[model samples]
Target chain A: MTDNQRLYWRATRRLTVGLLLVWFAVSFGAGILFREALDAASIGGAPLGFWMAQQGSIYVFVLLIVIYCTAMTRLERKFGIDQKGSDQ
Target chain B: MSGPLWSWVFVGLTFALYIGIAVWSRAGSTRDFYVAGHDVPPVLNGMATAADWMSAASFLSMAGLIAFLGYGGSVYLMGWTGGYVLLALLLAPYLREFGKFTVPDFVGDRYDSRAARIIAVICALFVSFTYIAGQMKGVGVAFSAFLDVPQNWGIAIGMAIVLVYAVLGGMKGITYTQVAQYVVLIFAYTVPAIFISLAITGQLVPQIGFTSESVLPRLDRLLVELGFTEYTQTTKAKIDVFCITAALMFGTAGLPHVIIRFFTVENAQAARRSAGWALAFIAVLYTTAPAVGAFARINFIDQVNETAIDDLPAWFETWESTGYIDLDDKNGDGVVQYRAGADNEVVPNRDIFVLANPQIAGLPAWVVGLVVAGGMAAALSTAAGLLMVISSAVSHDLMRMTFRPDMTDKQELRWARISAAGAVVAAGLLGIFADNLGFVAQVVAFAFGLAAASLFPVIVLGIFWGRFNKQGAIAAMVTGLVTTFSYIVWFKFVDPDPAGWWLGISPEGIGFAFMWLALAVGVLTAVATPAPPDHIRQLVEDIRIPGAN
Candidate 1:
């Protein structure tokens, strides 16, 4: 309900939506739907689509998570909400 | 050392290591038992999570499945790993903020309803037990192939090992043991893969070998020459692939065992960091798996085709006796003929190739021994994690949350251990008879869909949507379960008709559609119903902030 909380939530939604779209595009779009079309091209002697499905997509997924983790951590710090309270 | 000797040595050493770790970090309290006292460092927790997540199936069978299915296997590769993104971004931080012992704890409190918690417990139990049975079966199969033991004996030994660690050490023992298991299993997986890759393509890294011209193009040409689908050709329908991948993604994020690992971390930042590390460690094996699959297929064909029965390797006969390799000379020919069609005389059980890969490539006996230990590690670690979830669901959710509110930590800790022991024994029995009970295999895959349809959407709603009341939560679970459960049972058992599949989406892919369907139904029902109580809304808002601590 506070302005700061509202702003943080909105920022999170923006980051999540943007990242999810990239996730969808890499895994679903190139990996499956447009696979045949992309297969005409190649990566490291493997077809791009096949590479995307088996190797490239997985690599990208990890990168996305790392990016999200760092960005989210920064976002937390920006809002002055980053805390490391000890557990009971 | 000889073959069995090497196997025994590696297996003995790993078993001793696990038991030693368990004894060193024994759980003394309920907190230590459940979430390892919430003091685990992020990177170490990540290693433990990686071990807990990659089961016997991933260790033994995923590469084999990829080999046979070719490009169609993309669904699994994308499905399993992609979900970690969702977990890190959507679920882990909020759930970690909630800081509970189990998934039901969050559901029960967030919804302010006992019914919601009970349903969550049921869903968690069903998913975990379904998954655990398969892990048990995996343990048996791996042991029989590598150790010359009967499947039942393998299951029993696995049960005893899990009993010592999980029952005594609880999650704390399981956590440290899993870190050790991760190192062993990853070393076991990658060392052989690297050797095979070097032999085949002269590449040190298997991922590079997978994409190299020597492997993919040559493998495709060889397969086409032998009347098989080209190795890289797309076989599955695009829509079905999309559906299965989505279903698995959501299902992985929803998994109670995986989700609970995040709770073991110090804070939300640690949870996010650990998710990244877990996926990185898992990707170490997953990325190598396809390369291993491709190399194994090539090696398998070369070893089988046009070879005389007497000329076949000794390992071939060994695997054949275990029923993993069936080389029936159907045409009464002295030479073995392995092709795509029915006349193909050599039909190796898919998993046999992975086990036989080292031998086929002429690796030393010690490598084979390492693999046996690796497979056992993968199976046992996952089984321990699932057993923890089962015991927690029974003792924490069903007993303390629902009825006995005044139960002390000491008493609950005892119950947790008791239930864990009970679960391992029951799972061992299921493993022994897994083949006869055909539905156990079906239920393994069914676990993901059930989680996808029921718990996944509800948990997401509980954190993100404040007004998602108990009515909507109940409705979503019921509708999700009813729809996904019936569809799987119908297609998998009764009909078995590909043409009759709804939109040609297999039961594996059906979870994809139904996840969204359940989410929509949940949202509509929640909106139509009276809003949830004010404190429940406040609780949602509280967990949304990572700094709430």
Candidate 2:
């Protein structure tokens, strides 16, 4: 593979792994591991840990996808791999 | 109008509309049949995927399951939706760049081996069939409860309606029809939820209404008073919750029907955006599900707890006639004390909660009918998608690619239709005979577990890891499939509780263990074996480089 291509691949992998860590934290972390601690706090009248497990994590997941989409679009442009082949 | 008549009108109208769509969008070629001619826009594809992915289990059963399981049910909420992130980022775009008609097509070409393709086909067929069986049973439950049709007849009617669209238009018809079904099912799901939420908490949005101070603490106290666990407290073991959630997330990514929905879009970028759209659409129902669960549980307890059995509401009587909810005077006190124990007199089927919620809440007859129609839409749309995947596995992967290399596109399309019809019949039979298997939700979980263990690792590694060869891919698929399937069958059907389970992971959560096993075998085999052929390496590079197409 060319150096540019290899660089693009590496950057993509780094971005994906980073985003995945966030995903894991919101779900497996707040929702599961630290659920008891969060439950002691409250959100919108329900326990925060319960809300995170049931609702908050899902909202975070949707946000994570949106972030990944926007970030990837920008990365593709920076790497000159965008569908239009222009920085814009 | 009577409830059954109203249900018929709504269900019949929806069925007619689906048939109209089938006739209008019938497939004309192999490409049209398989991938909707690869011309569907991202937003429409997203809607279609949402409908296709949200099966009867999601619409009719999940909220009921959640309502009963309380906080433990977050596994379904998180596991099912969280996988979209994996699909959008790790799998969908690269597979779209590969630009294949089916998932097995990607596997076959990636490994450059027909054997790999066939194994993938077997895995896809197994998952789709098991998944479709749950959809068919969902159809049966909805029909029997709402329309008063016998369970077998419900399965047959659902099979016939699905046969019309899926056989005629193939993926093209299924795609457009699914978009319509999504609108119907989501509206049907949220309207009743909104009504219940407003009644209970005076909040318009069910998502917030559920968490709002209006109802939860009271319900949690009531549950405790009734000797039940707190509604919002953690009830399941954390390890089990973690493993099951992981299994579901990975399993969702591996589902062939969902993956194939991405292929209908135009490009990798559209595929990425479409995944986002699909998740947004799915979130509409998923976020509402918890609220529905909470409201329904509260409503159920409010109406039934400490009430005389004979004086129970008409909805209870109706649900009892369907054998879903039973009232027995176990203590001979003649009052229903709804509590969690074998001695408890009231037994409510988890599947009945969602369908019965409208009636329990005293909603209008039309709303109840709409809920019925929505349940049917969810079941039929998902069944159509699964049948399509099974058909393509048979016609494209097994027949044309493996057996008849010289088959024309016309012949292949004919075979695809035949296979779809055959699959519907097989699924219908399975639905009828496998009534004892488990609830719709449990059966679908098995499908997800199998998919997560078998197809997920291979597909993810094929796109990302350049050194993953055919041997490693096959070994991973086989080991994952065998271990997961054997564990589930042994625990579920054979032993009912095997002492051999590691860390006390139930059959529903065991797939994640096998997934790791597959990953280890795959990496080890890849390292030990020679690298894959150079052409395969170039193909991997091509798929990785965005816009290469």
> Which candidate should be chosen as best, given lDDT against the real structure?
2
lDDT of 1 by residue, B290-309 (tens): 99999998988888788999
lDDT of candidate 2 over B1-549, digit per residue (tens): 988888899999999999999999989999999999888999999999999999888898899999999888999999999999999999998898888799999999999989989999989998998888888888988887777789899999999999999999999999999999999999999999999999999989998798787678887898888788999876677888999999999999999999999988877888899999999999999999999999999999889989987789999998888688878888999899898777678889998888889998899999988999999999999999999999999999998999999999999999999999999999999898778755444566578888999999999999989999999999999999999988887877678764677798988888888999999998899889889998999989988887653
Clashing pairs in 1: none
Model 1 chain B weakest 10-residue run by lDDT: B436-445
Each model's interface RMSD (Å)?
Answer: 1.6, 3.9
Q: Each model's C-alpha lDDT?
A: 0.89, 0.89
Badly placed stretches (over 4 Å) of model 2 are A82-88, B436-442
Best candidate per TM-score, number? 1
What DockQ, between 0 and 1, does each candidate earn? Answer: 0.71, 0.51
Which pairs clash (backbone N, Cα, C closer than 3 Å) in model 2? Answer: none
